[model samples]
Target: MPTARESLLNAALMALAQLPWSGVRMVDVASAAGVSRQTLYNEFGSKDGLARGLARREADTYLHGVDRLLAERTGAADRLVAIAEWTVGEARAKPLLRALLTGCWSERLPVPRPARRGAVLSKAPAQRRADAGLPSPADLVAAVRDRSLAALEKGSRPSRTKEESAELAHRSEQAVRLALSYVIAPVGEGVGPLVRTAVGGAVGTTVSATVSATSPTAADRRRLQSPV
Candidate 1:
């Protein structure tokens, strides 16, 4: 079962899917989660803080799923394709994720334009370097990767070599961006086939080739795998 905090956060995110962030009050989330206003504030501090945490959690979940797909025993190419397909498919399925990506709720709320941008660009230096650079994307990714590796050890392949990590990370990032774009932009079914093909090529080259063809320079591989 989810903790009280987790339940509140999920309820808040689900409400966000239905209403613009500007209009999404803490009370709404509290009501949805069967909690009180003080409880929400106590747990999240402020509306912006709650929003930030929710967005980060969602992005982390998506990338974690990609990590799992990449760890499967399939060939690198097949694994790459699987990751792309799963990403795009999930983007199609999760209305809340799409809403969060596009700031769809903004239309209904009075939020300033900048906050919407911040939500989408969660990895910007400003957001990533919060708290005077106390913690970084490297820290978050390491924690997530460690957990993912422990899960993969159950049946999937162990961690990859430096080259493989670079390849997978490059491809995974592109796949994530493409999925976000598709979710927000809403290209029609007519364009879906073309988009898929283009994204497939893009993801394959951006990530797979980096790992499969030649080992990148030690420095470059380290940078790519660092997740910063």
Candidate 2:
């Protein structure tokens, strides 16, 4: 069973699918989750806290998928490509993910407006307390990049020296940044191919050689090469 926090977050997401974030009410979310309004406030502090918690939960879901690919996929390049593909795919499918990743809100994801004077605004004190738990967008991005780099290093061939390990880590960070740039704005090419090129260039390897060494079948290659 989902915890109260999880229930609230899921309710928020469901609300997001139906209405813009700005239009979602804490009371509505609490009711949808079958929890008291006070329980919601206790868990998330404020609307901002709930928004941040939702973003964190979604980011965790995406990163968990990336981690699974890192563990199951062979070769650094292959894993990097897979991660990029997943990121692009999720961002395309989920407006909230796209906004969180790009820091830009589209029509599908209007910015959250402040609540007008009413019962909602009356709960300002509790909301202010919870707002402290929210992480900045930059913090969220940095956390994802750091985790990705660590996964790359763990799966990489053992470095001969500390300097080599550091270099590989740096390259991994660069690979993630390059992929994110494309995620923010595409260049009329498939995400997988673009990511493959970026990762290959960063690590000084050929994409084909990386894929072949991993022994991914035709279907797997097709899946990677196809646009998200």
Candidate 3:
């Protein structure tokens, strides 16, 4: 069963779907959640608090998805490619997520702000968390990078040297940054090939072999051989 907090957040999201944030009233959200208006207020002190809650949820959900996708048993480059592709798709589908990732909030979004300093804390733990402020686009990129690096390193061979480990982390960040760029600009088609190229080719290849010349794709050949 969904908790009252979850129910209320869902109600608010439903309301958001129907109207802009400015048009969404607390009373209506409580009514939609089948909770009292006071209960709604109790969970979230104000509309801004509710917005923080929603943004917190969006960020948590995105990171959790990244964790799950990274857990998949695949080659390292392939794993990075998978998460990059997923990030683009997810950012497109979720408004709060897109705002969180790209730091580009539309008028429809609440654009969460942290709680006022020296203010009384919310009795709700979740609300306190929301009050802490949401991560920026750069913060999220670093998070994705760290998470990707950890996952890739964990699955890698035990004999890896410090330099190789550092290289792995670098490639992971490289892939994540590329994904963020795509999220911001959104080049046509998928983001997979570019991400794969950034992280090097194939699953089993080492970082030393990255930007591989053994068998470059036609496009890779063009890019490498280009004088411009």
Candidate 4:
């Protein structure tokens, strides 16, 4: 069963499907969630808080899916290809996700104009003030890229040096950015092959160089073989 917060967030998303964000009312969301307006306010504080909560939930959903894909697939190339395909497919299915990822809102989405002074003064975390508005496109892109880098690092063979790990992470970030570019504005060509080739080539070259430079000790081999 959904908690009060989750229920309210779901109600907001359901409202968004039919109404623009600016037009969505807290009263309506509360009613839809089978909660009182006061409960909604107590849970989310303000409309901005509600929006941020919804965005964070959606981001977690997408990232969790990416994590699952990474675990199921073997090889860096295959995993990268799967992630690209999943992103494109999810973007097509969820308008909100697409808007968040590409920073391109359609007519269906409410136009998020600048907030008024009083609106900005609402009781929310000072650090979350920026999130009170729609997240910047760059911020969204960077968040996804960071997740990609982390996933790549987790799957990579243990690096002998920090520099090697950083290089691998950099390559992963680049591949994610490239994939996102296609997601934002497709070029009428398959992105899977392109991303796979680029990521696979980079990983192969990096691992080969690392291996040639220094062989893994017996302990290192055992650690690599151990289940994570």
Question: Candidate 2, clashing residue pairs?
Answer: 46-127
Backbone clashes, each candidate: 2, 1, 0, 0
| Per-residue lDDT of model 4, residues 106-147, tens digit only | 776644444455654434453145344655666655665666
On lDDT, the candidate that comes out on top is 3
Off by over 4 Å in 2: 106-141, 155-159, 201-228
List, residue by residue over 1-228, the lDDT tens digit for candidate 1: 886678787887677668777778788888888888887766655676566556556656766786777567344335545654565677567654444444564354322222433343333343432212222334433443443334323343455565565445544444445545655676665333343354344344432344445555655656788966
Identify the candidate with maximal TM-score.
Answer: 3
lDDT of 3: 0.84
Q: Which 10 successive residues of model 2 have the least lDDT summed?
A: 207-216
Candidate 4 local lDDT, residue 187? 84
Cα displacement (angstroms), candidate 4, residue 218, comes to 25
- Global lDDT of each model? 0.54, 0.66, 0.84, 0.69
Q: Across residues 1-228, which tens digit of lDDT does each residue of candidate 3 receive?
A: 999999999999989988999999999999999999999989999999999999999899999999999887477888889898998889888888988988889999898878999978889999998898889988988898899878877755677656566777778888877877888887787888887777776455654455333323434666888998
Q: Which portions of model 3 show Cα errors greater than 4 Å?
A: 202-228
Clashing pairs in 3: none
Candidates 2 and 3, the one with greater TM-score: 3
